[model samples]
Target: MGITKTLNDDLIANRSEVSIAEFEASRRLGAREGVGGAASWAVWGNENDDLTIFEDSAAISPRLRKDVVLIGANFGLGGDTGEFPPFKNFHARKSGGDSKLRKAITGTALEGAFLTDIVKDYPTKDAKGLPTEIKSGTLDTNRYVLSGFKTEQEALGLSRDTLYIPMGDTTRILWDLLVDRGVIPAEQRVFHRAYGNGPLFKERPVTYLRHYAGAVDMVQAVQGLLAQLNLR
Candidate 1:
């Protein structure tokens, strides 16, 4: 009924290894030079103050590790607080709408030539009108999409030209298998942070695992979709 229930059920029933393999492969590709552009941005400090693009090798060298990775959750990183602090409150009512803030963030990332991806989970229906099935691992029946510009100058097209990947249940299972195999760390799990104070903002690390998997799936999906749409 709810997203968590759906994902959990999928994880329990999923039985595939291919998805995880694909996810790892994509991660390798994303990390490769000349495949995807790289840029630096600040990980917001407390209250979003002291913004600084992470440029120092010392600050970013850890990301070069084989196990180090980045997973972009659907919502912004900071979980909601009842009151918006000054720097982090750029999305507050006084500021522009969330959409504006999102665009600004994306724009900044794009300017730095960073690749961005989006992943979403939605229900699947069979001809009989019943929920068809749940997927596991990195790939899920849920849709995983990827989009980004070929170059920083092309960034403007990102808003319109997203590629899609149609992943099935087996894909998700493979992701879980990879996790079990120690290919990806559990801490890299991705989850959406709430925008405002909500019960869901308590910050459970496990819940974000699905989101991390979703990010991997998105990268692969985008590559496939681009080939299919002849946009590559």
Candidate 2:
């Protein structure tokens, strides 16, 4: 097949190449090199406390299939280079003061279209040491920590035709722009429900595209996805 009829348009628009030296520097720690049965709709979420969802949607596209892998690195918090702060600061925090800081940080990071978080309910401690319910809003500054891997998985689900690749802690957003533009068949938009076996081959039918951990993984996964579909 020519570039896999099912490939997404966003994945086609942003494919590129890089040096081997760059590739080695981007691999993630503890990322194993084994393939298994692909879950058609695996959604990643941070701990229950930080339940951010990652998936393919018009709002959060997973720019599937490309040669270049995108990855994210942490520069620190409250600065231009770090990952976004918790959703409370980015979205729900009151206006002005730290709000400006959060906006500045988010705007800079999201300039190229990266996915982040939104505020949610979390647990808190009361004066008597009893567990209390606290909205993400009331946390003191610095209480919000960047989310982790499981959280990333909870937000996004991968199946036969779709995969969730993380660019840093943020899931690289992807949309079915092909469907939006009416380029691909409407029935091919598999993200709305579970992916079917029609997209798979052999036992290891689903292929996950990834690269070096952190920022590089995102680029590598996109590249891998493109290469795979192009061969189809």
Candidate 3:
């Protein structure tokens, strides 16, 4: 099928490619090699706090697909070297952050994995003043950045012809944008509504997770959703 007939113009004016290396790397990671479900799978988040979701998703299924893209919010201008989120700033205490979690997640397919951020070429900057995000046929990360869900869908090379699964609030932001454009149903836009379908997710609400083990439950939720979504 072509673009979705179910919706109108949802993409931005452009869809340019930013960092070729980053794009290729992320595409490789998002591949579903020897798998049975999606051709690829990627995850985007609000900030570093959401890495736990990625970690947990991988923990539950160690042999999980690598076609995973962790999209996080990247603020500020671009330089030659690609940019990553200032993850430390997001931590609550900042001084004595989650050490064990860091050890478990980093270099293990979770922490600091790079993808195109919503801030466009900020993740793969070579010069100072260049277009990043989305435009024409160019594509950057925009799940919640400039063009929001439209750019995100474009980055995925998808339209309403395909389906979307928003795992957490970060992705929910994009879903809400689709709703704004009359793409998604309004009822699914509930902010505080339940998210994942895992046992731990059902045991504790997303809100309650913050009060306790934090990223622990968040990881469970993403794993549940990914397991469910991959089947499609």
Best by TM-score: 3
Q: Where's the lowest-lDDT run of ten residues in candidate 3?
A: 5-14
- Predictions ranked by lDDT, top down? 3, 1, 2
What tens digits encode model 1's per-residue C-alpha lDDT throughout 62-99?
22211111223121223332122212322223323322
By lDDT, the best candidate is 3
lDDT of 3: 0.31
- How far does residue 147 in candidate 2 sit from its true spot (Å)? 16
**Which scores higher on TM-score, 1 or 3?**
3
106-196 in candidate 2: lDDT tens per residue?
2221122222221112122111111111123243211221122223222332122332232222222221322343322344323222222
- How many clashes (backbone N, Cα, C below 3 Å) per candidate? 13, 44, 18
In model 1, where do residues sit more than 4 Å from their true spots?
1-49, 63-144, 147-232
Give the candidate order by descending TM-score: 3, 2, 1
lDDT (CA) per prediction: 0.26, 0.25, 0.31
Q: Which model, 1 or 3, shows the larger lDDT? A: 3
Listed per candidate, the RMSD to the true structure in angstroms reads: 18.5, 18.2, 14.2
